[model samples]
Target: MAATKERALEAAVELLGTDGVRALSHARVDERAGLPAGSTSNWFRTRRALLGGIIDWMAEQERADFSPALLERPTPETIIEGLCTVFLLETGPFAARTRARYALFLELAADDELLAPLSRQRREFERWTDRLVTEAGIPDPVPAARTIMALGDGLVLHRLTVDPELDARPVIERAVRALAASVG
Candidate 1:
């Protein structure tokens, strides 16, 4: 049962990411997952349920990819390196997941009920960033964290949608250095 659901969600991610929200449906997921008829619907009765499951699954996948050790003792260099690595993954190897996430971000923007779970993960990340910057000696850690997160998100979006080959390391380094300088 769990395996079936996992396959369904994985297929749903690929479908939603590669083809956009319009391409998502129980039949498509079932076909893509190679499950029998009605299998997807058995697990997810509605489109909303399927979407929510995908959101949770994606959050889990991303969390697993992001190791806590990377930012354990955040410094400007570590932060820049971490962000650059994340940028590369998001725009390259993990582009499909990024696209799926952005699709959900837009599709669920007006639906608070559906958006809440997605936003929860983002909030936790922001809190983590807050702690990271604080540990790095940023006096105004909260806003700095937000700025950093926003900048990273924007850069990833641009890389995914605008240019797949954009090298964002220099931009990330400059930004991190500026943030660090603000403290000194």
Candidate 2:
């Protein structure tokens, strides 16, 4: 049962990533996952439920990869390098997930039920960013953390579509240094 649900969610991610949100449906998820006709519907009765499941799945996957200890005492250089690495992964290996996440951000902006889970994911990262910036000697960590997050998102989006081969390290390094220097 869990395996079937996992497959359905994976298929749903693929659909949302490749074909956009309009292509997502229980039947399409079943077909994409190669499960029986009722597999997706059995697990997620409504589109909202399926979207919520996907958001949860994404959060689970990300949580497994996150390491809070890494931000214990980070420097600007470490932050820049870390953000650049994440940017590369998002634009390259994790491009599909990135695209799907962006699609959901735009598609479900007005729906609080769906937006809540998504916001939780963002909030987790924001907290991490806050900690990193504060430890790295940024005087105002809150807005700086938000700026860093937005910068990473914008850079990832640009790399994914506008210029696939763009180098993100320099940009990240510049921004991180500027933020770190804003200690007063």
Candidate 3:
């Protein structure tokens, strides 16, 4: 049962990423998940509930991907590597998940209610980045963190959509190194 729910959510996310929010329906999710008909509706009775579940699932996946261990060491090398790993989407599953997340973000831009959780998640991530910059002895952590985040978002979006062939590691690493050096 738990597995079925997870599969349905995963399928929903994939659909959102590939086909946008309008394509998301209980039947569609069931079909994408390869579950029995009405399975998604059984799990998530309403479209709102289904979207909320997707958001929760995305948050969980992101928490795992950006584990504390990854951010424990705030050295420029670690930061650069971490940023590269996340923005580059070197893995297939991670890339797909990220694409879905970006798609959801666009859809949620005008939806304050749906964007609330994601907004909190964004603030949390910024706080983490600020802490990392402070630990690195950067005098102005806030601006540095914001800059890093902007650079990361730009790179990730570009990599995901604009130019799939664009190589992001070197660019991200160089930017992080420069930002750290400027403040050091």
Per-model TM-score, in order, reads 0.95, 0.93, 0.92
C-alpha RMSD of candidate 2: 1.4
For 16-126, candidate 3 gives per-residue lDDT tens digits of 877888888999999999999999999789998888889888888888778767868688787887777766552345776777777778888999988888888888889
Candidate 2 lDDT for residue 154: 90
lDDT of 2: 0.86
**Descending-TM-score candidate ranking:** 1, 2, 3
- Angstrom error at residue 120, model 3: 1.2
- Across 1-184, the per-residue lDDT of candidate 1 in tens digits comes to 9999899988899898899998899999999999998999998899988888889999998888886677788988889988998888888778888899999989889999889988998988888888888898866788888889999999999988888788899988888788878853
Residue pairs clashing in model 1 are none
lDDT of 2 by residue, 67-103 (tens): 6765567888888877877887778777888899999
Worst 10 residues of 2 by lDDT: 63-72
lDDT of each: 0.88, 0.86, 0.81
Per lDDT, the best of the predicted structures is 1
* Model 1 spans with C-alpha error above 4 angstroms: none
Q: Quick one: how many clashes does candidate 2 have?
A: 0
What lDDT, from 0 to 1, does candidate 1 have? 0.88
Whose TM-score is higher: candidate 1's or candidate 3's? 1
Off by over 4 Å in 2: none
Looking at candidate 1, what is the lDDT of residue 67? 61
